[model samples]
Target: MSRPIMSKATALKISRAQFDINKIRFFDFLNYKFRFLFFCWFDLPCYFISKGQYNFAARVACTELSSYAAMYFLARWNFKPTLFVFLLPFAILRLGLMIGNWGQHALVDDVDPDSDFRSSVTLIDVPSNRFYLNDGYHTSHHLNPLRHWRDHPHAFLTAKDRYSNEGALVFQIIDYLEITYRLSTKNYIYLARQLVLIGSQVGMSQEELAAMLRLKTRKFSEKEIAIELKK
Candidate 1:
C-alpha cells in the first residue's frame, strides 16, 4: 500500500507552528503537546477533529472502543459483572497518564522548538526516572532518539553540565501535575522561582513569562466588565 510521506524538516515545521499557536492558551497548549497515554485517547483524535478530518477521528474513536471492548470481554470471561467494576479505576488511570505528558514538557522553551534541550524539561530525581524508565531525562531522549531507555541516565549525566549551562528546567521533587496546578491557580511567583532562566537565550522577558503564567485574571474593558457583572 502506498503511504503519504513527509520530510522530517516539513514535519518539524508544522509541529513548531502548531506549538506556537497552541501556546497562546494554556489548556490548548496542554492538549496539543501532551500525548503520553494510550495513543488515540485524546490528542490524536482531537488533532483529527481540529483538522476537520472526521473520518480519521471516527476511526481513532472506533479503535479505542474496540480496545476497551476487548479488555472488557477478557475480564468478563474470568470475573463476575460486579468484579468488573474493579476495571473502573483503569479508566481514571488512563486519564492521569494523559495528563502526565503535560507536566513533563510544560515549562520548557517552546520558543526554540529546534533545540531538544531548550524544548524539553528534565526531571532529575531517581523515583521519576526509574518509574518512567528514564523518561524523566526527556532532553536526552530527544537528543538521542534511538538510545535505549536504560541509557538515558548515562546520556543525561554526560551532558549534565551542558544542560545546566543551557538553562534547562530540571525539577528534582515535583512532577508535571503540580506545576500545572500551580500555574492554573495563578501562582506565578512560585512558578517563576522554579523556572530556569532561558529567557535571555529565547528572547523572552520576565514580564512575558509572568503573563504566560498568570491565568486566572483576564483583562477587560470597563464596559465589558460591567456587562459581565450584570450577567
Candidate 2:
C-alpha cells in the first residue's frame, strides 16, 4: 500500500489551523521556548539526517566521540586541573550559541515561512564578519544556502530593494547579546520598534502587534488571529 501524500495547500492549511489553535490556548509562548531549546540541541544532527547526509552525521558523531576521549585523557594525565576549570567558560559560551540560534529566527513572518528574506533576520552591527563569515546576512545565505559565505554581501546588495519591500527584519546596530537579552526579558516593544514596517505589511494594527509581540498574552481569538494573518 502506498502512503498518503499531502498537497502543499493541505499542509499549509493544517499549519495555519494549528497556529490558530496555539494562539487560542496561549501555548505559542511555551511552544516557541521548547522549539528554541530543541533547535539548539538537535537541529544540526536532525537536519543532516533529514537531508540523507548519513556520512556527515557519522563523521560528526565520530569526531565528537574522539573529542570526548581526548578531553578525558587530557584531564587524566596531561592537562592541569586549573586549565580544565578555565575551559568551563568556553563550554558555557557554546551552550549560549544554542539559544542564540533561537533568537536569530524568532520573529519569522507569519505569511511567508519559506521566503528567505522574510523568514530570517540580518545582524548588521558586528564590526567584522570574519568569525561568522558574513553569515549575519542571513537572508542572503538562505536565498543561496550552498553559496560561498564570502559571496553573501554581494547577494544581499544585489537584492536589497526586494528585501526591504518584503519587510525583512534587519538589526542595524545590535549584536547577538542585545537580541538575546531583549528576548529573554520579554522586551518585545523595544524589539518591535526596531522592525521595519513589519506591522503594516502584515496588516497588524499597533495593538495587535503589541499583543502578538508579548510572550504570554491572548487578546485575540484563534479565528481573529488567523483572519488578521491572512490579510
Off by over 4 Å in 2: 1-43, 78-89, 128-131, 196-231
Clashing pairs in 2: none
Per-prediction TM-score to the true structure, in the order listed: 0.54, 0.62
Measured on C-alpha atoms, candidate 2 has an lDDT of 0.54
lDDT of 1 by residue, 34-61 (tens): 4433444565566667658787778877
CA lDDT of each prediction against the hidden true structure: 0.55, 0.54
Best by lDDT: 1
Candidate 2: tens digits of C-alpha lDDT, residues 163-212: 77876766656655576567666666776665545323466665655455
Q: Candidate 1: deviation at residue 26, Å?
A: 11
**How close to the true structure is residue 60 of candidate 2, measured as C-alpha lDDT?**
59
Q: Lowest summed-lDDT stretch of 10 residues in model 2?
A: 1-10
